[model samples]
Target: MKALAHLNKYLLKYKWYLVLGTVFTIISNLFGILPAQIVRQSLDLVKDTLDVYFAFQGSSLQSGIRDQFYTTIPYFGFLILLMAIMKGVFLFMVRQTIIVMSRHIEFDLKNEIYAKYQELPMRFFKQHNTGDLMARISEDVGKVRMYVGPALMYGINLVVLIVLVISYMLSVSPKLTFYVLLPLPFLSVAIYYVNSVIMKRSEQIQAQLSTLSTDAQETFSGIRVIKTFVQESFFADKFRAGADEFKKRSLKLVKVDSLFYPLVMVLVGLSNVLVIYVGGQEIINGRLTAGNIAEFIIYLNMMTWPVMAIGWTTSQVQRAAASQQRINEFLNEKTEIVSRKKLMTEVKGKLSFRDVRFVYPDSGIVGLDRFNLEVAAGESVAILGTTGSGKSTLANLIVRMYDPEGEIRVDDVPLKDYEVSYIRRQIGYVPQEVFLFSDTIENNVRFGAGELTMEEVEQAVKDADLYDNIQGFPEGFQTRLGERGITLSGGQKQRLSIARAIVRQPKILVLDDSLSAVDTHTENVILNNLSRIMKDKTSVIISHRVSSAKLADKIVVLDEGKIVESGTHESLMNKGGVYFELHEKQLKTEELS
Candidate 1:
């Protein structure tokens, strides 16, 4: 119930719908009570006539009373039928209104989640998985929708049912009502105690299910790697363990389900027995009339639903409450990396870093400690480094992936003050890992760049040295790239990535080790072609090969997360520093091969 308070944003939008739905619910419940009231009075009348037939004591005095009861039975029956029909009509209206609202809520929630994911800093996605995110949007949102719609409606109805039944019982006979309902408060207290446990258990279930989905998704995604290592048995054991854990939690839920209904039934049975035993004695002692006892029995029947409904609604409320906790966690996550004060529209590609420092979130190691560099616009430079030299970290900071605690600027404007979208638009980035979508080759090449003519696409392909290979395909540009372009070779995929970036045509293009797997001949051709293609654009190429870095206007070598030496290929060779050592080492390795 505490977690449900987070629904303020969604509920505020549809306040009128909620009010209208509850109005209809109360109306239906009010009308729903009429049939029980009418039936109770009609049965009481029949009991009066039976008492007269038996010629019980004071029968002569009760003749007119019995006559009046018989006369009014038919009218009560008519009233009962009228209320039943009205209940049906309004119940349908309430169902329609709430269902419509539920659909809108689900749609809005999904959109909000998607929009938030897009607005979140890239680091959020770097640490999460696609399938896990998909599960939240699809599966978790569906749970919230169902809870908001049917569960809420039924819950409101339960409250109304309890109130109406209790009032009718009190009017019938307050003493008998109290005697029969003495256990109800105790039951209410018991349900309240169990509600917390139910909430905790349901939350566990949802989390376990999400983890199971993530495991299955990751297994499928890395099936190739698993096969390469022949780790079928190991993964099978891992999956079995996860499945058993899920089964264990689910069985706990089943145990709760099995216990809850029977407890409600026991309380209801106690109330029924009290009504019959105590009400019958009151009738026998002449303190209560037989007709009154009959009405009391009818009212007792009316209380059954409110009892069961309270329990059912409790279960639903707990589930919904548990679900809100997970959703609120997502909504409240603060990246603290995004700009909130102002939006800067003009962001040029002049990249600069001044005494910058950063540590990865929740980690102690400095990704960029005292990093300092500057690249003027239209200067082609290459960053050479080993795996952990903060090469990619430098590029990520330029795009604001990791917010540096120290100063970094673009076009002389602080990166945080500049609009994120504006800065991203001016720079084209092709990551080390190429991930083409499961779409046509042309669409992947022109992704998010809008429509492109065949000539434009072909020219970009030509510039990336992939034009000839694509032309050889039977479908050519129309060829569908299978999942992540697995249908294409490694070099072809890298070239397609280059083509995609080329289509963006930004002022600064950062290729972060995007060509590490291509053949030597293809790499040479790509490097040669890139020189002419990005003649005026500032290009930041990250590579390990001397052949690739030789084309850059300047080469910057890094070791242990710090810059060691930086200069042109000829100047670096004359200096005989780390760059010269790397060039000679690579040449020796090539000669040995």
Candidate 2:
């Protein structure tokens, strides 16, 4: 219940809807209880009229009394029917206001969660899995909606209906009403026990649901790997085990849930028995009439559904509280990365890293150690490094994906001083691992800049040396790709990623081993095109191949998170150290191929 208090803002936001729904609930209950009174009066009328007919049995006055009784019974039946129709109308109004408001709140809540996801830093994503995130926004939010809509409506209905029905019963015969409500205290005890059980099991079920969703999502996302390794049976058995656990828990929950209605029904049956026996005693003493007994039974039966609904409403509220707690966990997280300043700064592509140090937060692995570098405006610097030598870390820092320990500046301005969004917009980065959307080729190329024209898209494709291959396809630029661009070859995917970056015409361009998938010939052609395109823009090309580094204005060699060599490619080759050895090994491997 305390967890559900987070929804107070939404309740306040749509306060008018709740107010109207409550009013309608009251009016509907008023109409609903009126029929029981009508039944009582009708029964009493029949009893009185029969006595009069029997007294005039041998007289002509008996015929007139019988005719009047028949005429009056139809009027009471009509009133009951009219009351039901009015109650139905107000019930509809109750749903329209409260139920519809729940839907609006669901919409608002989902959008807020998604927006928070976007605002969070990459480290937050690393800590959580995709399936868990999806479950919160979809399944969790849905449960919360049930609490706000159906549970709320029925809860109000239960409270209001009971008050009106009980009031009428007491007015008719206080002694009979007392006996009729004696079982109610026991029913309250049953509800309290059921509510505690439901709350505990509901949270367990939701947690398991997230785990199951994650398993299924990961299995589907990596189906290719499973098939390649022939591990289908292995994954199937794993999934089966998880499903079995879910079923076992669900049945436990169902067993408890099954007790709700029957327990309510038994209490209701007890109340009815008390009504009959107690009313009979009162009648025998000439203290009550048969009409009073009939009225008491009618009122008790009218309250049956609302009383039964108490358990169900409590279950829904408990489940909602559990789900809201999960959603709040993510909503309360504050992203560490945000703009220190709001003003946008112009970027001219000058980069400076002074004693930059970084360690992976998750693994505690040093990515860079007191590394220093500089690049002037309109300069091209190519970084050559072995595996695990911090080349990609440098690329990530330039894009401000993760801030390093020391100073990093773009255009002589501290990276943190510029608006995060503004700084990211000025850099065009193509990562080592290419990821493409399930969209058309043209759309993927223009993903960074949606406003790019078809002509501009084609120019970028040509610049990446992918124009001829694309033109060969029947759909050309309109060809739709599969997930992660599985329809295209690895080399093609990399080239497509390059086009996506260069299409932005960013002032600072970074290609982080983006050409690793392409053949040497295709790589040379793309590099030649980039040499012309990046003549006036600062560019950083990170790779292991000397062929890629040879055309740079300056070449840097990194080893063990530190720069070991920095000079022109020819100068480094002349030094005959690590760079020279790497060049020799690559040249021989190429000659053999």
State which candidate has the highest TM-score.
2
TM-score of 2: 0.96
- Per-residue accuracy of model 1 over 402-486 as CA lDDT, tens digit each: 7887788777878888666766777788888889999988998888667788888888899888989988999998999888899
Query: CA lDDT of 346 in candidate 2?
Result: 72
Those runs of model 1 whose alpha carbons end farther than 4 Å from true positions after fitting are: 44-82, 125-135, 285-298, 340-348
Off by over 4 Å in 2: none
Q: For candidate 1, what is the TM-score? A: 0.90
Candidate 2 lDDT over residue span 274-309, tens digit each: 988989999899988888888888889888998998
Candidate 2, clashing residue pairs? none
The lowest-lDDT stretch of 10 consecutive residues in candidate 1 is 340-349
Among the numbered candidates, top lDDT falls to 2
What is the C-alpha local distance difference test score of each model? 0.79, 0.91
